[model samples]
Target: MYFISTSSPDEYSTKVDRMIGENMDLTRDLEFWMSKLPACLRALPIIYLSIPGSHNSFTSNISGGSIVSLDSPKILQNLEWIYCIRHIMANWTKNQNVAVKEQLKAGIRYFDLRVSAKSRENNLYFCHGMYSCKVEPVLNEISTFLETHSKEVVILDFQHFYGFTQQTHGKLMQMLLKTYGTKLLPYSDHMDHLSLDYMTSQFSYQVITVYRSDAARFGQPLFWPSASFPTPWANTIDHNALFNFLDDKIKDRKDNVGFITQIVLTPTLTDILFNSCTTLEQKLAIDFEDLRTGWISKQTPGRRGVNIVIGDFIDLSDNLFTKTVINLNLKLLRDLPKRMTSPIN
Candidate 1:
């Protein structure tokens, strides 16, 4: 049980009493965990909440036959003509094992969406090293989930875009607005004041769409800018380096903004070439499972603490990765008073 240094024993006990009285069971209600959160926890700013996310979230559909996306490295793009090379790229690029709807059911609230506009095509597609399925169907899946699970909130982070003109950006923005309508939470400068209770209960807003592009500035208020959610990548293959990078980032987290700790590792070209026959999960992610789980178990959520923690192949290890991140919210009960100050309407 990790407690914040500022928490007093009396305050901790009182908070625990409230939580027990509310009968909050995170493990039992993994599908609708946010709806089951204690009132004290729900009242805290959303930035202070613990959320589980997947890196390259839509890559599950990527395969050897898929077109190599423009955002991939030139080497991969050039050699994509070869079937074996494409297969290798597919293995390394595909991060999530399940679809978006399944991920939502397994307690993942944040989505790392990297999209690209296919040449001569009107539809948008999600991409990593290679392109995946069309984007609209996936968005429909998420929208359907939120329709039934009204109490749950989800963060749709459009982190990267490839081969898109100004017109294409507009088309995508329109699609988003049409799909979610009033469900999208409008951006606010006072992010610390926005909580699950404030958005869901008062406004019925359940989606936070983060579009990382200059186009977002000229688009609708529903599309939040990237600065509101600064997701700094660790960009390291070594587990020790990744751990240190996460610790340092958390210590220097900016005020009044959402932060994402990307727990996935990036393999160097040499490592990728040497392990071409193996998938990124077997060659890298699985090897660091123990260290990753240990680090997540020790995290706490707060204004400057862990917020959105993302990983690769999140469905692995019997969904323990998502479960551990969700349970971190229980720690906030001990320090609820610190977060209950002057929440913005």
Candidate 2:
């Protein structure tokens, strides 16, 4: 719900033009859209954005197993995310601000197309088979852009790719900060959902942000069924024990590295959070799971779950917790720990 649209005024004009082209009136649908925003669940301190900045008001917490209810599969507010993507794609073609457009496109390429299957399978945290192509050039372009323009640039590498500190990504940030005097913006996304501990003590800070994707992207609910295709289920689990362990790993690693955190929530859960768009929120509540359960033999199809929801890669405040990752997660993890434990809890 909290869309950190840093798109310039030109982007706005483009969007408005699209609205006009669609023959839809923004004023007429103002309240309608507002109503579609998510509402915070009563039980938890979940944050929903009825309007811009509303989400900023709510603090973030990691939701482990209960990812966007596997039912909807449509990323939380899929239409909105898609809209933003299309908007960026539209601008990526021919915007006056070439730098901004390119940067935005790089972001889209990284978050939208690259990090589709982002998830923590075991101890690895993050994986990247999804991106068969190298992202080096994109990183170079982004670094150059940041070095030239952004003030306190925040990378916010949302577990979108594999390792932010991976040589390619690390060097890009270094080039930017080193080439220009601008300090590299810290990366902030999901720590548990990524494998960043391989870097040196301070290296991860420059490369990775804490995991907020799980909360902002996955923690909440959407819609899904009991059994289905290649796998009977869609969503696995989003719970506290897993989050607690992941948080501990992140906390333990805090000493050597600096990081930013994000939030996660499901679709229906997100609808309840923002409370911005009432009708859409309600419409999303429909049982998408009930509708699609069983084999994909023209009957059931995999739900396009909320894979990623990116935010403006900008800093909020300077003051932050400086905890030493006393209990390093990487060290404790066993290759397929769950396999040794019989049935994973």
TM-score of 2: 0.23
How many steric clashes between backbone atoms does each model show?
A: 1, 72
lDDT of each: 0.87, 0.23
Per-residue lDDT of model 2, residues 1-345, tens digit only? 112132576664464344334433212222122121111111101111001111111011111111221112244324423443323222211111112233232222112112222234211121111112223343454455444332112233332334333443444334334533323222332222122111212232222122323332332122111110011111112334323433343333222122222221133334334543332212321222122111111110001211112222211111000000111111111212221112111
lDDT of 1 at 186: 93
Question: Taking the tens digit of each residue's C-alpha lDDT, what string does model 1 give over 164-250?
Answer: 999889999989999999999998866987889898988889999999999889647888998898888989898889899999999
lDDT for position 255 in model 1? 68
Strongest candidate by lDDT: 1
Query: Candidate 2 — worst ten consecutive residues by lDDT sum?
Result: 318-327
Taking all chains together, each candidate's TM-score versus the true structure is: 0.93, 0.23
What ranges in model 2 sit over 4 Å off? 1-127, 132-134, 155-236, 250-256, 260-345
Positional deviation of 228 in candidate 1, in angstroms?
A: 0.6
